[model samples]
Target: MPAVRTTFRSQNHRGRSCRDFPALTVTFNVLQLMTIAFVWLLALVPLTLMALGATMLRAVRPAAAPPGAG
Candidate 1:
């Protein structure tokens, strides 16, 4: 019957669509991971600069010895 043939075609299309799902999912996950990594790197910049500045200050001004340690 024509209906049976149409159902078969529909099932074949659905099978192809299902097969394509993993690739699409992987692409989406990769994009999401990249976005998250970009955000984390962006957030880290200020902290990284602050830490670098603190290190520079330490090198510029050595800590004085404590009176009790003398």
Candidate 2:
């Protein structure tokens, strides 16, 4: 009976440890998502700047034709 009680106790402890596993998994997934979003935002900065620069250049340039056209 004592050995059986010991086995049950050990099993109970193992189960208790696993109770927090789901919450940890969720937290890990959220962190990974945040990291991915940060990387995407970093990548977007250069493209956004390039687009803005192009728009500004077009706005500032004169609409005159090329010099070679008679």
Candidate 3:
């Protein structure tokens, strides 16, 4: 209840509203989302590449024959 009452007032105090500045809000939202996505990409890409490299090496290496086999 209190939060709802202050929401519009806060926007008015800052002179920014979605209706008043649609493009600005959309751009800000996009940039925020992109920042989060970029962080995840940075963290996952290296781990993914390392795992892929390990899998490739595992596939490339052949298993040795059993000791008792001729």
Candidate 4:
């Protein structure tokens, strides 16, 4: 076994962990999450429009009854 050395070290701030987020980090995270959500909804727009069109088409006509069954 040889001496093992660690390359990554944490930042120091009054014994606080480096993972503590600054204002910019939090803002970026929120923006990134919102962007992803926005893209997801944008991707669904086509499908939603198709469904609306189908509903409109359905509203345009009713099913015809069988002969002698009216």
lDDT of 4 by residue, 1-70 (tens): 9997654655544456536768767898999999999999999999999999999878755555456664
- Give each model's whole-structure lDDT: 0.80, 0.80, 0.81, 0.78
Total clashes, candidate 2? Answer: 0
Candidate 2 weakest lDDT stretch, 10 residues: 1-10
**Tens digits of per-residue lDDT for model 3 on 1-70?**
4654445466546764578888888999999999999999999999999999999888765545456663
User: Which residue pairs collide in model 4, if any?
Assistant: none
What's the lDDT for residue 36 in model 3? Answer: 100
TM-scores of the candidates are 0.56, 0.58, 0.62, 0.58
Per-residue alpha-carbon lDDT of candidate 2 for residues 1-70, written as tens digits (9 for 90 to 100): 4554445456547557545699898898999999999999999999999999999888766555456663
Given candidate 4, what's the lDDT at residue 28? 88
Query: In candidate 2, residue 37 scores what lDDT?
Result: 97
Identify the runs in model 1 with alpha carbons over 4 angstroms from their true place: 1-19, 63-70
> What ordering of candidates by lDDT runs from best to worst?
3, 1, 2, 4
All-Cα superposition RMSD per candidate: 7.0, 6.7, 6.0, 5.5
Error at 60, model 2, angstroms: 0.7
lDDT of 2: 0.80
